[model samples]
Target: MQLKLAGLEDIEDVLTLHRKYQIDTILEEDKKDGFVTTNFTREQLTKLIQEEQGLFIARHEEAVMAYVMAASWQYWSVWPIFARMIADLPKLTFAGHTLSTENSYQYGPVCVDKAYRGSGLLEAIFEFAREKMSHRYPVLVTFINQINTRSYRAHTQKLGLVVLAEFEFNNNHYLELAYDTSKSLSLHQSTHGQH
Candidate 1:
């Protein structure tokens, strides 16, 4: 498997994977696994690749098995949920720093193929995106819907993201989580020798 930033050429494959788990189109039974709320279009994805440089993916045999999106608050502020998150940043603290746009970036809507759920691909791809974004920001922030226990556990238990606060947006409850970018799984792996 390969983990790297996604270029424009990879958008179609990413979208194909996204549609299978997106909230609107996902199968009813599949919701328990997890679902992505945002439905990104080709135009939006193009901007994400060219401007934000924030789309990361994990590919195996040329298939996009998983993807993670991370970008500045400004890039995300257009969405109401993100706008609210941006306004609440200063009130939350993590990793010995007061959160703000200058010091942190929003991450999420990560999707992994069901076949690879328990194989540690999530941690690998997540850390790949986090390590790259750390060059510009010291912190990474993301919000997961309160009902999505699958995602909450994966992030908190597997990836070690801390829940800074919980808030309601448009009547939907969400858990806001953050991670210190300075900490890398590669470093952790090097010391513990875990693949």
Candidate 2:
């Protein structure tokens, strides 16, 4: 597999993988496994690539097997939930720093195709994204729906993200997670040359 920043050409394939596990359209049997709550569009993805350089992907056999989105609070502020998260940033702290828009960025809605779910792909791509974003941000933050036990476990267990807080939004409960970008997950080398 190849891990890299996604280009415009990757939008469709990324969306294809996204729809399979998106909250709105995911198969019922898949919900217990995990699902992405955010919905993105081609134009938004274009901005993510051109503006923030935050769309990361892993490709296997030329197909997008997993994708992770990270970007500044400004880019994400368009969404109400993210706006709320931004407002709460001053109240959150991680790795000896008071989290702020300047020192932190929103990360996630990571969607990994089921075929590649447990093959070390999640950790590899996650580190790939964290490594890339570390240049600009010292902290990475994300949220997982409380109902998404699979995602919460994968992130907290395999990735070691800290549960900083929990909040309710739009009647849904979520766990807020954060990590120090300077810390390495050490899985990048494991995915080498799989492309």
Candidate 3:
């Protein structure tokens, strides 16, 4: 198995993995069941694939076995820091961070193909992503709905990410965890050659 940054050709497999996780997250409720459903189309993936900001794929024998995607952006008051990141990962750095927007790296849509489940692929993906992201951005953050205990457990096991704040949306609260590159991932070694 090998880990690589995602590209246009890998969108389909990524999408399949994403949809499965999304359904798994919503299986217990009725309207709430299919409520989180997304009709995100192929065109959308095509567009995201072109951005190259935050996405990755783990391939086994040329097929995508797991994937993760996030958007790298800076919020208001972070212009200077954003500039530093741009200079660091110049080729893949984005000039898109805005002062009025919340500066953050949103990670998610990570899924490992079922057949390969429980094999520690998720931790592998996150460790790889954290090293790469920490090198590029100053911080990394992901939000897990308060009720999504399964995901919470998974993240803690892998990244040791824990609650930093809480957010209310649609009358539901989500646990927000923040990762300071220097603090959270300084000692982690890559599971692959990339690091």
What are the Cα lDDT values of the candidates? 0.91, 0.92, 0.58
Answer with 1 or 3, whichever has the higher TM-score.
1
Alpha-carbon deviation at 116 in model 1, angstroms:
0.6
- Per-residue alpha-carbon lDDT of candidate 3 for residues 16-100, written as tens digits (9 for 90 to 100): 6566556534345422322222234676566556764467789987578887765554321133433433333322212343211
TM-score for candidate 1, residues paired by index: 0.94
Using lDDT as the yardstick, the better of models 1 and 3 is 1
Put down candidate 1 lDDT per residue, 1-195, tens digits, no spaces. 999899999999999999999999999999999999988899988989999999999989879999999889998888888988989999988889999999999998999999999999999899889889999999999999999999999888778788999999889999999888998976755655655
RMSD of each: 2.0, 3.9, 8.8
Tell me the spans in candidate 2 whose CA falls farther than 4 Å from its real position: 187-195
TM-score of each prediction: 0.94, 0.94, 0.68
Compare candidates 2 and 3 on TM-score and give the better one. 2
Worst 10 residues of 2 by lDDT: 186-195
> After best superposition, candidate 3 residue 108: deviation in angstroms?
1.4
At residue 14, give the lDDT of candidate 1: 97
Model 3 vs. true fold: TM? 0.68
